[model samples]
Target: MAQTVSFMAVGRFEVREQTAANAGVHMTSTSPHREPIRVGVVGLSASGGWAATAHVPALAGLDGYELRALSASSAESARAAGEKYAVPLAFASAEELARSEEVDLVVVTVKVPHHLELIRPALEAGKMVFSEWPLGADLAQAEELADLAHRRGVLTAVGLQARSAPPLRYLRDLVAEGYVGRVLSTSMLGSGWIGGATYDDNYAYVLDITSGATLLSIPFGHSVDALTMVLGEFRAVSALIENLRPEVTNITSGEVAAKSAEDQIAVTGVLESGAVAAMHFRGGTSRATAFHWEINGTEGDLVVKADRAQWWYGGTQLYGARGEEGALTELPVPARYQRSLKQWTERSADPACSVAHEYALLRDQITGGLAPDTHGVPDFRHAVRLHGLLDRIRGAARVGRKVTLTEQGS
Candidate 1:
């Protein structure tokens, strides 16, 4: 027989079996389980936000991570957030949270501008850090952070969760196993979110290229990253970036703001695998404007597409067909590709499902010392590499000539 017992304290949900021994309770060992990784999330809010919607729920659903602490700009906000999320500790500053012995890992989800400030202290404290995409304001910042982590000897992870996606994982395997035969070329087209007509005040920062949160870095970067993951890295490339909508009216303020970020992105490159690649991501969304990426090979072709522009939000439909197969047939992503936690599937529209997968991979890496793989977790070095590629693309666009990526440090 099993008895139900609950505690109202810090680490309350941590389950332990106990047996009656005299007047005291003795913990009985039914099975051995590793303690959850204590995570401290900086910039987590009391009200609903990105970390709240995705990270919080994802962490809660997993057994390998404990939502330990939350940090906000002020002590009041931190306390409120802690209360709202039921987190044990709340700190008003990143340094405090980073230095706390209660936290085994520091997760930096703040904006790009504050990333360096929030993450640097955590790295200095020798605590593992997980920063969101666009790891820094630019490539140089990303490299600096990577170097810092290297010097500190602390592990780091990035929010390039698209790499952990199950669909892309299966797609890569299918191509490698000769389902797509010898890959010839690949192409992708998607919306940039701000590419359409109206604009929101909340998304105003994306219009500024300096913010590093523009269409190019988020959607285009993730999409291209997924593409290259299935295919291979780029060798030489030519890129063209243009800003058609120079001025946009904020829906909330009804005030026009200068949009400097490029809304139209066109890049053609050769993959290290000898396959040619072409990608064009436009701004804004429409009924017919869907995110589509196709891979053409000698034996057959494969297509990965989504109704919405974002890659991580919903599971993209994958289709493939060989010579005898009449039309493109649906290639279902196998159950093996799915997350161990089924709760993630319930929120298909949220990107946190894939984020959860990344978190799981990181947990394993931290607790079990698992090595990082192509389809598993990505670190700051990976972010630096992607930043270098984005920089090379920008350089190619600026020079109006093809640029080789050999010189970029790995």
Candidate 2:
């Protein structure tokens, strides 16, 4: 049997704590009329491509959700995703899926360059949306989306779910409970081997930015999201972006592939809580890698390793790892390639009932007019923040200066 731990439902956060007698007692029964959420998924490539992958699977396993529809750029792919993922609805066009009155929310899993096209329509339609990170290819688009969402009061969200992991949540709770006392500095070593050629010509807009999924968005972007989750938001940052591998080929196939996007990014910034967060992203390596971070406070220390970096909501454990620390201590996050496997199994649930957790909050926002505790879902505004940060990094490098930022959501 799985080990049970004490937990508290603080806002949307399921943080662990030792104080209260009634922690993790399943207070969900008290909140009714907050019925199951209806959901649609678009893009279905990589993470999206593997719609049957983690996202769908996680939603499928959760108690209150539905998987109403699946969308892809091509009719065949959309059909394939629906058939493979076991969704009743499938559409080739994003607009068709986004406009589903039956769908309370949509999950955008398309490429970074396609984010704007995929996002604006859903927001304008007055629907809640959740998309993969790096909200935009750059800041201007991100800002435009954020501004629009804020103006319309649309419920939007992003995929920085690492904040929901047990260990990280535990760490955050510990810090709040005085385990780490007053935090001083935090350093994250996020390294991996996403070094390969990209076949981005299929998507034209990103010629100036990047090619493969490994470099810019997945590795660096997710790292930033996770670090921010662990250390808090940014107070300006100085970044050094690098394209280490001028020529690289896909590991799966032995052929020359075009390379454009950044291979490495180093950033150091202050958290909104005034703690420091420093991180480095390096790509193109001989082997796979892991992530690790530490928080130093006035009291003791809180640390987490990649093996402990698992994201879950309900029963979904997307990607797992057991490290040198032993099975008990190490978490079993879904393996990277295995993401789509779980999503495929999620077909057993009603598509309309498989909405993600973020959308649950979003549905609440729309219907009940309540505020979300952590509205970090990948909406238009977050796109703006991410893009703005990217620009700051580029500008800092050009001027050889550090960019100072005010507190986030300020």
Candidate 3:
């Protein structure tokens, strides 16, 4: 037996209430048991976007989850998406989708600026939520959403999918298993593909620093999250943030615009384990090297490289050398690490591969198969801490000084 929940439109928002008992309706995972987590996605357009390119395929390829509903910017678009994706339900607004009793999880894959508005309603409706990274436009907004989720006592997840990548997972275990014994230092250099001299209309918004979708927040943010995942959190950091290219050309329209976002970000810090760390990220792709990271230890060293800065998506390769070895050799990810992802091996570059892995972990957690504390499954609280760390990096750059992080991540 289950109780049906109804929602009434109150101005711009929806208010939810228990209406009556429903004999056939299935309850959410909040009931402590549910065969499949029904997911309703916000911003899943029929015209194609990140949701179409990644989330849709990821859900389709996974088990214990169903893409039950979707919400686009308009009713027509929603209907188009529902028909296009063969989803059962469609809504014109995110709030409406969030209030639907048929949806157990609300996945918000909208833009960074709209995250707070879209995610708040789902949290208020007491539904599980999964939002893409940069959980909010800024640190304060992320903290606010995290606080509200905490108060509501709901399960929430943030899209830091790099942590779930098989190669990265194997890399983490190698370090933990003493492959790189007594790590001494590590360094990473990457190119911020979008922050370069050329831009498209779709990405023009990121050129404005106030939009909160800058190079530092998206590419650097994602890459650093994976870095911290493998090497632990930073203890203290000093940074130099600069805008080397103030003007960028629009590739499509041939128009020039002033780019306020920083193109050069260099950070030097010490990890919690006392390992020295240095990372430098620059705008535009490098003809020589797009992504390269190395870990040096007393016993050996490890190296990771990719064609692009975004290693989470794919093309990431791991290499290592130890003892008297004069050269580095490729280290294949263990079969066990990629057991569930065998089907995605041929299409490793597809964004859906890593996303599918993340969804699998999420399913395991919801179904009581995996512990909530499992690594790589980041929640809203973790997003807040990462946001705080980003804030500290900005503060350190602004003051030209070193900032130390505390246990509480202030």
Q: Candidate 2: which stretches are off by over 4 Å?
A: 1-35, 45-48, 196-216, 270-276, 285-289, 307-379, 408-410
Among all windows of 10 consecutive residues in model 2, the one with the lowest summed lDDT is 22-31
Clash count of each predicted structure: 3, 43, 0
List ranges where model 1 is wrong by over 4 Å: 1-33, 345-347, 369-375, 407-410
Write the number of the candidate with greater lDDT, choosing between 2 and 3. 3
- Note the Cα lDDT for every prediction shown: 0.78, 0.56, 0.83
TM-score of each: 0.89, 0.71, 0.91
Q: Which residue pairs in candidate 1 have backbone atoms (N, alpha carbon, C) closer than 3 angstroms, thus clashing?
A: 195-283, 195-284, 196-284
Select the stronger candidate by TM-score from 1 and 3: 3
> Cα deviation in Å at residue 265, candidate 3?
0.3
Q: Once model 3 is optimally superposed onto the true structure by TM-score, how far is the C-alpha of residue 186 displaced, in angstroms?
A: 0.5
Global Cα RMSD, each model: 10.1, 9.5, 7.5
Clashing pairs for predicted structure model 3, backbone only: none
lDDT of 3 by residue, 1-410 (tens): 44565433321223232222421111122223456789999999998999999999999988778899999999999999999999999999999998898898899999898899999999999888889998999999999998998677667788888888889889988998999899999999999886899999888888999878887888889988888888888999999999989999999888999999999999999999999999999998889889999999999999999887677787688999988998999998877776566888777778888888888877765664553234536788778888888889989999999999886673
The candidate maximizing TM-score is 3
Report the error of model 2 at residue 265, Å: 2.0
